[model samples]
Target: MKSGQLNRRVIVQRATSVSDGAGGQVREWPEIGRPWVKASLWSTGRGAGGGQSAVADVMQDNQAFVIRMRPRDIATGDRIVLDGLNYRVRAVVDPNGRRRELQVSIELEVPENA
Candidate 1:
């Protein structure tokens, strides 16, 4: 809850639909706000396939992260970009119920060939 704990910079973005001039709408992620947050690694999981063939084994990394920052108008399905990586907001909570701080839970899944 202390300001000093918020050492990482993160950009909060929301999905917006814009007209593509073709009678259709395109989803765009626009920056809503940037805030200093404290990010902590909650959990991590790695898995591989049972059998490998010609293709390399797929490595899936699911990471759970919790970030704490000042209260803001953020919601689920919003994205938090940090260090060029995008994370999806899973849940948000006001830990103190005073609206002074928010504990946001976010998740990131990376699939790579190993």
Candidate 2:
């Protein structure tokens, strides 16, 4: 991928678990940094809804994102915010295997309260 196609400014986020002050834990996403990336859909699938929070397990539409090589560590469960939507990272891989770039496999997240 060319550098020009990666025009989308994206904020990388990672989940941090902390006390909710009620003896329970809460997951908070903190912005790691902003990076430019080329986003594209890898595949789309039909989703079935079971309960309020089981939608993602039923089906998922996965996307493949290509971003400029980054120096930080990227992992699963990290998300990229684009156009105000959260694309949850399902997997991260070095596409070229030469460490020139990252290929992030993702799925659209369905809010539990929505």
Candidate 3:
């Protein structure tokens, strides 16, 4: 039998600002946590980004992402359908090794306007 899919909670963090020990401040020194991220892996493939250099150079692309539902309802390797849109899961990774949090990247089928 095939294994059942599971859903997990993940937090997305972005750099912010905070006070230093000496009552000073710095950029990219603080991070704010975004809660309630729901996504699942649809499929996996060779990373898309590449560069030509002295040696064969390649880099892992941001995992394609699609928000499946509001609040939270998705799992690893599950196709996400959000707002009538679709995205694929690349992978979930730890953020910066500063704290234990999962970072998920999703590639939008259609780009959004800011």
Candidate 4:
């Protein structure tokens, strides 16, 4: 894939644990950088949230985006933000088997909407 084909601008974020000083940890997502990626969305549907009785807590499994980039700088826990939507990294694969290009599978989360 050509680098110029990456049209989507996404902010890269890493999940970090901050010391609370109370023997507990506060989780935070800190922005590491921004990278342009080529995104392809698929399989948008509603997903179950919590328990069956908690229908109010139901979530929408909207659009799993496949992003193509160079190398595998992102891990499973890391995520990308684009247009107010959070795309959590599900998996990363090198298509060339030489680490030249990485295809990242992501699950999209739209806050309360999904």
- Say which prediction, candidate 1 or candidate 4, comes out ahead on TM-score: 1
List runs of model 1 lying over 4 Å from the truth: 44-61, 109-114
| Model 4 score (lDDT) | 0.71
lDDT of 2: 0.65
**Per-residue accuracy of model 2 over 1-114 as CA lDDT, tens digit each:** 567867778888999999989999999999998887766544344332111122234235444433343445777788888788887877676645677766665667778897
Which residue pairs in candidate 2 collide? none
Lowest summed lDDT window (length 10), candidate 3: 50-59
RMSD of every candidate to native, in Å, equals: 9.8, 7.8, 15.7, 8.6
Best by lDDT: 1
The lDDT of model 3 is: 0.37
- Using TM-score, give the best candidate's number: 1
Off by over 4 Å in 2: 45-59, 62-71
Task: Indicate the residue-level lDDT of 58 in model 1.
Answer: 23
Flag regions of model 4 displaced more than 4 Å: 43-61, 110-114
Task: For residue 30, give model 4's deviation from the true position in Å.
Answer: 0.8
Rank candidates by TM-score, best first: 1, 4, 2, 3
Candidate lDDT values, in order: 0.75, 0.65, 0.37, 0.71
lDDT of 4 at 33: 82
What is the C-alpha lDDT profile of model 1 across 25-97, one tens digit per residue? 9989999999999887753332212211111222124666778889999998899998888888877877657
True-vs-predicted CA distance for residue 34, candidate 4, Å: 0.8
